[model samples]
Structures are given as structure tokens and as C-alpha cells.
Target: MNVLLLLLILSFASTIQCDIHTNRIEDTLSTEANDTNTLCKDHLQVPEKVRIDLYYESLCPYCKQFYVKELAPVVQKLMNYIELYTYPFGHAQMKKNDNKTTFECQHGPTECYGNGLHACAIQYLPKMSEYVPFNTCLMEKWSTDKDAEQCGQRLHLNAEPIRTCANSDEAINLVIYYAQETEKLKNMSYVPYTVINHKVMDPETDLIDSVCATFEKPPQECKK
Candidate 1:
């Protein structure tokens, strides 16, 4: 009975840890939005840095696995050496009728809703750093409405603007645009499709190694 109780407690703790967000990227931003022109200010692009363009859907299991298991740590290690861009459009189809587009997501409506929120984050959030933590929140291990709300609040973002933009017609159009962008990817087959420096990569290979290989002057993290 004691052993069973201990296991239960451990599981509960693990769940809490997975769902919690502390020190989100927004908390560390040296800059904040105070001007309309800079509301979505992008980081300066260095010509010499490597680029990673990620295309994914909100509820793909494989995408989640690749993100949390592979891409997350690799990005951390290569943070200074790479530029990361993400599109939350995957195996989704859109049909236009009467000047409106209806979306058909691979994982259904809930996934579409999730994708909308993520897209809003990208569109609204000013810093690239902020997007990672926000997306990380969306990818919570114990995914729930409570978790989502907590994640947003943790990032010091008001929920109303994000929700409004997500449900708006504009967001749908942007998702469609992303879908078209994904379709343009060469050799595309699945969600979490990665394009490193504008080249589609095999999903089975180690993305970290691939990222390191592209560097003009590989950082110390690449040596490890």
C-alpha cells in the first residue's frame, strides 16, 4: 500500500512539473512593445547564421515528439547560431467559398483551434524568444484548458487579444498561407517537416547534427 501511494504521488508531481511554466521567454525580453510600428518587431537577421524553418500542425503526435524530444534542446544549444522560423500549418486543406475559406485540419477542429492560437502568438508576440516559450506552453504535456490559460498568463499576455485574433477571419487566411508555404516545401511528407537553410531534411536523421553541419563557424555547443 505504501509503495502504491508513493508511485501515485510521484506521478502527480511529474504531471505538475510538466505542466508548469517558470521563467518564460517573455520574462527575459530586453525590449517590450510600446509603439505600433514595433508591435511585431523582428530580430535582426545575420547573413552568416543558419536558418531553420519549421512547419507543423497543432495536434500531430509525431510533431510533438520531434519538437519536445529533438528540436527543443537542439535549438537551445544552437540558439546563437541559428534563426528559427515556424509555421503552424500542416496536413490541412482549405476550401474557399463565397469569399471565405473553411479549413479541414488533419486532427480535426480542436487541432485547428490550437493552431490558430499558436499563429496568433507568432503574429502578435514581438520577439522570437517569446514565441518559443509560448509554443512550449501550447505543447504542454498535460494539455488542458487550464494549462493553456496558465501558460498564457505566465507569459504576461492578456488572453483576450490572443483569443480574438485566433478566432478572426484573418487568422484563418494566415493559416491557409502557411499551408501553401508547406506545400511548397520539397520532399514534404509529414508534419514537423524541417527546412534547414531552405532545404528539406530527412525526418529520421538527427537534426542537431544537421544544424551543426551548416554552421560557418560552429560554436562550442556543436563540439559536444
Candidate 2:
């Protein structure tokens, strides 16, 4: 009778241990599932970058007007929320002659020269804070002097580097690069063409509206 009682007690203890092991595995799996859910929720909350690509030339009168009137304000307001990339070759094609590359513009030779200066500004100075004002000032004064040396002087930007870059190999390549970019857009029909988040914006509509519409999480100012 004593031996039988000892065997029964041992069996009961083993059953209890088995139950505890099973409960531990269930608890571990539940914790792991909860952790995965939390990670997925956090990842989904992160915001995506908004892209704005502007293709324009310096001396194109319509492009200049749009820059001054339409784009500047929206760029100033949504600077943080959007990524802006400006390409200064509009409806222009590049060709090689006498071991040097030359670009032809829609407007004229003067427009071509002005566009070169703008490319120089972009190359020599990458900062938008300085480059935007310089571009605006140059556009305002473009009719008087297509070379834009005087505009550089007026804007307090150094003119010599810009003049040097106008005819340099780097500037030529940059303009060519921009021209290639313009060519990639299937619906590109004219200067001042704007693309927002890889989609070509409507020609009849203003791009500022698209900028506000495309943000994944619009800022409070945008809501206003």
C-alpha cells in the first residue's frame, strides 16, 4: 500500500510540471505576437517624403513669371514638407561641336546664355536660400543683360565664378543632364513644366494646389 501511494504522488507531480511547461510556451508565444503587432503599428506611423521637380529655364519669360508669382510662395511655406529639385534646361537640346558641347534654347541665343548663367549659379552655389534670390534677381534683370554679370553684382553674389562656370565642362554637362531629365517626361510640352511625386501636374492647373493635396501628413499651416 505504501509503494502504491508513492507512485500515485509521483504521477501527480509529473502532471503538474507538464501543465506548467505548456503554459510557459503559450505565454511566450502570446508575448512574441504582441511585440510584432506593436512594431508594425509604429512603422506604419512614419511619414513619407514628398517630391517636387521643377523644369525651367532662366530667360523663358513665362518660366520667370511663374517662378516669381506662383512657385516662390509655396516653396517658402512648404520648405520642410517637400523636397524641391530645379532643372534649368527647358525645351533645350544639346549637341557636340569642335570637341565642346553646345545647347540650343527655344527663345534664342540670349536665352541659352542666360540659362548657362543659371546653371553656373546652381553649380557654384547649391544653397536654395542664396540661389533662389539670385535667380529671381537675374530674371528681373535678364532683359537688360542676358549675361547676368550685373545681376550677380546686384544680388551680392560673386560674379567671376558664375562667369567661369558658364562655359566650363561641368556646367555643360549639368545642362545636358537637365535636358535629359526633361526628355524623360512623356507629357512634357513646354518650359516651366512641374512634376509632383513622379506624376506630371496638369498644365491648366496651378502646381501649388497639387503641393498641398499630395502631402501624406499636411502641416497645421497647410490645413489653414
Instruction: Mark the regions of model 2 whose C-alpha exceeds 4 Å error after superposition.
Output: 1-48, 143-155
Q: CA lDDT of 217 in candidate 1?
A: 69
lDDT tens per residue, model 2, 1-224: 99999999997886665555444433443555434433443433322335778899878888998888777777676665666778888888788889887878888877777777777787777776667777777777673344357767777778678777776776677777777877888777787888887788886787677888887567765766
Lowest summed lDDT over 10 consecutive residues: which window, candidate 1?
Answer: 33-42
Least well predicted 10-residue stretch by lDDT in candidate 2: 40-49
lDDT of 1 by residue, 1-224 (tens): 99999999997875554333211222322223112112222222222356788888878888877777777787667776667888887888778899978878888888887777777777777566676776777775433345556878898866566667787887787787787777786667777889897778777788998888887667788899
Best by TM-score: 1
